[model samples]
Target: MTLFWAGAYALTRVAVDKGNPDMGLPVAWVLPGRLTIGAAVLWVLMLARGQKLPPLRDRKRWVAIIGMGLAGSVFPFFLITTAQETVNSSLAA
Candidate 1:
């Protein structure tokens, strides 16, 4: 997890760097791409292990899942990507 996060930070920095427009990618593209790919990979792994998703009808479970996703994944990704525009990746990490 540490290594994964470190790499992500570095990649985010690269993606947001204005000095390297050729290499830099838009935040709009990078964030969604990262999230989608990560989610898909995890979903595949879970399916391979026969893990079941929580029932969508469970309100509490749905709330918890949404909260965790926003807090743990989405918020941080947005914050980091935005910050990387002004801060160095090494410092952001």
Candidate 2:
């Protein structure tokens, strides 16, 4: 999780830097690509280590994942990445 978070931070930093402050590029393209790449890497790591994720058998857990993915991951990632284009890392953080 620590490493993944670090990767996320680095990714956002790079994305903001590359696109510049105006953010004229497509965030729809940007956000999903970053997420897909991260997800693929995580999936590969799990497979390589013979690790299994928890089954989404419970409604609460399912809700939690969805909520967190949207609220915590996607939303904040977009907001911070976009904001970082105009703001410093300290201010964004």
Candidate 3:
């Protein structure tokens, strides 16, 4: 898991580096693309394993879901990807 995350940061740095020829991906494109793909893949796996989502009508559940989504995944991803733009991936990771 540590290596995987490290590699992810390295790849992110490469992708987000605008000066790299034919390899540079826009910073704007990185976060959304990564998050969406990650989310889709996780959903597919969860469905395959027959894991059901929690009840949507539960207010407490929704709050926790939204909080985790923003704080746990989205915020961290955004910070790291953004950081890679101006800093080395190894340091950013």
Q: Per model, how many backbone clashes are there?
A: 0, 0, 0
- Of 2 and 3, which scores higher on lDDT? 3
Q: Pick the candidate with the highest lDDT.
A: 1
Worst 10-residue lDDT window for candidate 3 reads: 18-27
| Reference-based lDDT, each prediction | 0.85, 0.73, 0.83
Off by over 4 Å in 1: 20-23
| Stretch of 10 with least lDDT, candidate 2 | 18-27
1-93 per-residue lDDT for model 1 (tens digits): 899979988888877774675677878888888999999999999999999899889999999999999999899888888778778888888
Q: Write the per-residue lDDT of candidate 3 for residues 13-59, one digit (tens) a residue.
A: 88898356356777679888988888999999999999988888888
Best by TM-score: 1
Between candidates 2 and 3, the TM-score winner? 3
Summarize candidate 2's per-residue lDDT along 1-93 as a digit string, tens digits: 777666665656666674454654455667888889879998999999999877878888888888989997899878877776666655665
